[model samples]
Target: MTLTPTKLSKSEKTRQAILEAAQTLFYEKGYDGASVRQIAEAVPIDPAMIMRYFGSKEGLFSAAALVDLRLPDLGSIPRDLAGKGLVRHFLMLWEGDRSGIGLPILLRSAVSNQNVADKIHEVFEEQVVPAISGLVPEGEEDSCAGLIVSQLFGLALCRYILRLSPVAEMTEQEIVERIGAVIQFHLDAARDTAGSNRP
Candidate 1:
């Protein structure tokens, strides 16, 4: 509770340890499967300490689910290449970081837990929608955003979770090339539909 540098540093370390342990458990066992006792065991900390830091399992999960997609600024990307850029960025995030626990934890837990699913939806709706809203036709942002989310997450689920054959074996570049085109088409179609609908 004190603001001393040493105390603050130690507190932060314990907090991070709890989060890392919780993420691993959540990734391997899902929300319902991963319990506070298991997380505490993984961290080698007391369950009470975890409660002291995060309050409850839901609170801990909320903290652990935090992830920044670091989506590229669409305005800076070439208009034609936006889809390629977006897809490539996600591919990099997925394949490039074996040590990353954020996205995988969220993806894995979301399958069985309504809370995690809702959190995932909230994250994309808040972050992805605003990022590409300007590029989409007025009033079509939500639908367009949903389309983009489906393609990207679908690719992830097939390749990462389900480990389907061609998708699992394909190189990142192959994924970027194939999926990027589809994403681009969706973007273009959204804009086209908006234009046609305008008075």
Candidate 2:
């Protein structure tokens, strides 16, 4: 009997290296500051190979910044408390090592890069909308989703990015309680509006 370890193709290894370097550089230096050359230098590869693998700096960024919201399934949460559960999951993501990755990376770049901002918008449509669809009124998914995104991102911006006083100091429980209420209100508002039935 013989055992051999499977190996990643050279191309695959190169691609992974580029992404690792890209994420690190993008976090430290931001999209505008982290050049393709810098990423290539980190990988110790020819800069031309980067373009060959990813097509362009924008394409490379899109690949490296890909995010899965890893949204919690609301079905398991009580209907009324789904917002709290969702907010708690996001608070974990925002406050933990996940902060070093996609959400923060895209957010930091998005402030100055229109392309990154567009990428964030695309992420919202693809990930945020579907997660919120079951929680809000049928026709108001996008609207409610936008509200939730704005609420969560605003908190992240103030607390984590801007490092404002009270917000930054707020405990996770405080955030989950406060921000979760706002999210629940967004969901409740849509549901209530749908049932308002005023003509």
Clash count (model 1, backbone only):
0
Candidate 2, residues 1-199, lDDT tens digits: the string is 0122267777787788888888888877789999999999999899999999999998888877877778888867788998889888887776666333778789888999998999899989988899888887788899899988889889988998889999999898998898889999999998988889523
Full-model lDDT for every candidate = 0.85, 0.85
Candidate RMSDs in Å, in order, are 3.5, 4.0
lDDT of each residue in 1-199, candidate 1, tens digit only: 2235565687898998898888778878888889999999999999999999999999998787677788788988778898889898888777775444577788888888887888888878878999888778788888888998899999999998899999999988898899999889989999998888767
* Clash tally, candidates in order: 0, 0
Error of 1 at 98 (Å): 7.2
Error of 2 at 92 (Å): 2.9
Candidate 1: give the clashing pairs.
none
True-structure lDDT of candidate 1: 0.85
